[model samples]
Target chain A: MSFKAAVLVFPGSNCDRDCKVAVERSTGGHVDMVWHQDTALPSGLDLIVVPGGFSYGDYLRCGAMASLSPVMAEVVKAAERGVNVIGICNGFQILCESGLLPGALMRNNTLKYICKPIELKVENHNTAFTQGFTPGKSVWMTQGNADGNFVADADTLNAIEGNGQVVFRYVENPNGSANDIAGLMNERGNVLGMMPHPDRAFEAELGSDDGAILFRSLMERVAA
Target chain B: MKAKVHVFLKPGVLDVQGKAVEGALNGLSTVQGWANVSHVRVGKVLEFDVAATTAEEAKAQVKDMCDKLLANTVIESYTIEVA
Candidate 1:
């Protein structure tokens, strides 16, 4: 069985091509680059990636404008149907704004854009994306964003923690996110939103190959 | 009719921009009471014309806009004014 994936592209999305290449190389899957205004997605997608960048020029809020785009409506439906969905960086902000994920990505407490390689602990290995990594293993990836600080109310924090939906935690807590959460999954575990750029780190020469394991895990699941 | 929407970060949520502005303002003043600013919160205002005939209708419509897009209610709060 061949794995099928798609990378959604918004107007200001700079990482869409990188995400497509990473998924294609890592999973050996056919990837479709879908446009934001397109109302429909290619049929029979196994995974959907919301790539990072300042969508809609970060006009109102980081991801507020792009979340309401036509393609996101279909993306939300695909997520509801249990297709694996991953959002990275500004994509994480879009997912949160769209209500596909909980909480909000606030401005960095330091009020400066952060761009660096950071260590992330694999907090949950049971999910399809992180199954390739050992439990609690530390991995390296790049984080580049100004509004990557995550925040939610008390009840949401408690529920996500208790449900084991926290997928990854930052080792150094770069953006003042609550609980050091670098990544999160839905209660169903099929949707993930993270700030780090896994696609950017999938190759060894680029920095780290740890991210390939995530795509390989999905490929294995899709092949099965 | 016209609607004005004010969006603000919730009280408990940190307003980093507001804090920075407050700090800058305090640094510019040396008077005893001039630097007494506390609880500085930054917010945004969106003003737009609505096709509603009545103030109540315009408020309701603008409120829907806030809930759907203008404001992310998770860490932000919004107030609507119609004129």
Candidate 2:
């Protein structure tokens, strides 16, 4: 079975091409590069990836303007219908700003733009994104952002953790995120938002092949 | 009528920029002779004119804007004033 995927491209998104290439290579499937201005996504997509970059030049707030783009409304609708959606780095910020996921991405505790490969532990292996990995397995992926910190109220934090929604956790707590959360999934586990760039690590030539499992897992689940 | 909106990070939330500015102020205290500056918090203010007849209407409209877009209520709180 072949899977269909789409990579969203906003005005300032620099990682769209990376995501498209990774998805195509990993799934051996056709990938569409959807522009942010387009109001509708292609029909019958198994996965939608919101790649990283400074959308709208990080105006007002990171991902704040991009979240209101025309295509996001349709993306939100697709997510509600249980289509697998993954947001990486700035895309994660957009997801929170768009209300597809809860909480907010705040400025880094160090107030600096950090770019490096950090160790992440798979916290849950039940979701479509994490099912490829064994629970507690460690993977190193590139994380680059100024505002990568995740924050929420006590009640919301409790709810997400209690519900097993957190998918990845930073082993060394790089960005000072609440609970060292590097990634999380929605209540239904169809939508995931994470600060690390799995696309950047999808191949061995790219320095690591740890991220290929995420794409492969998506394909396997959708084909099932 | 004119409306003003103030957006600030909630208390107990770490304001990294605010802390940086506060550190700079402390550095200047010995050289510039400034005194009694203990802490600092940074926020944003947006002021605009609205086509409302009364201050109450303007405030209500601004509040709606804050809730919808101006502020991310998860990590932020906003106050609106109309004149």
Candidate 3:
């Protein structure tokens, strides 16, 4: 079966191209651009990506506005149907704002937007998204903002921990995120959201090819 | 008529930014007799007014506005008062 994927493009999304390139280059297949206004996604999409950027200029709050777009309603429904959904950076923000994932990304505890390469450890490799890499390995973070801390209630945190829904955790806990959480998954394990942009580091062209393994992992299963 | 709405992260949700601000304040011994304080709570208040005929209408409208736009119901809850 040929793998089909769609990348959502909001008005302020800047990373859609990188995300599409990552998927296309890895799978050697076409990646579709889905606008945030469209009420429906193209049929048979095996995966959907929400790329990072200041969607709606990070207005009201990060991902808060974009989550309400008609496109996200479809995205939420798709995630419900067990479609593989991955949110990166602003995409991660949207997933939280849309209630697809847990917790909220708040301003960094440093009160400054951080843009640097930071190491992150992969906590789980059993999901469709992170299956390509070994669990407990580190990845990279490319940007920062004050509102980047992840927050959730204790019950939600316990549930996430109980189900092993956590995907990535910071070794150094950069943003002071509660429990050092860097990424999350839905209860069903189909939806994954994280702050680091795997798309940004996917190739040697970006000087860090550590990102390729994520897409490669996805393609490996699709091609099998 | 204009009404103001205050939206903030609820009490139990961890306020990292607030803590950062508090940390900075605590670091400043001259600000308010500093050094010993270990915590500070930070929150944002968004003030906006809407045209409504009465207080009850204004309350409902402001609440809806908060739910839909002003406040993120997941991590934050909002309270409104009309004057």
Q: List each candidate's DockQ score.
A: 0.94, 0.83, 0.58
In candidate 2, what are the lDDT values of residues B1-83, reduced to their tens digit?
88888999888888888889888888798898545565588999999999988888888888888887789988888888888
- Tens digit of lDDT per residue, candidate 3, span A94-192? 998888888788878776787777788888888776788866566774554556788887898999999999988888888878888888888898888
lDDT score of residue A66 within candidate 3: 97
Task: For residue A176, give model 2's deviation from the true position in Å.
Answer: 0.8
Q: Interface RMSD value for candidate 2, one decimal?
A: 0.8
Name the lDDT value of residue A68 in candidate 2.
90
Native contacts matched by each model: 1.00, 0.81, 0.75
Which ten-residue region of model 3 chain A has the weakest summed lDDT? A137-146
Q: Which stretches of candidate 1 lie over 4 Å from their true place?
A: B30-33
Model 1: per-residue Cα lDDT over A1-224, one tens digit each: 68899999999999999999999999888999999999999999999999999899999899999999999999999999999999999999999999999999999998999999999999888889888987756999999999999999989999999999999999999989999999998999889999999998899998898888888988887777
lDDT of 2 at A26: 87
lDDT to native, each model: 0.92, 0.91, 0.82
In model 2, which residue pairs have backbone atoms overlapping below 3 Å?
none
Q: Who is ahead in TM-score, 1 or 3?
A: 1
What is the TM-score of each predicted model, taking all chains together? 0.97, 0.96, 0.87
Highest DockQ model number: 1
DockQ of 1: 0.94
lDDT of 2 by residue, A48-154 (tens): 99999999999878898899999999999999999999999999999999999999999999888989998999999988987888666699889999999999999
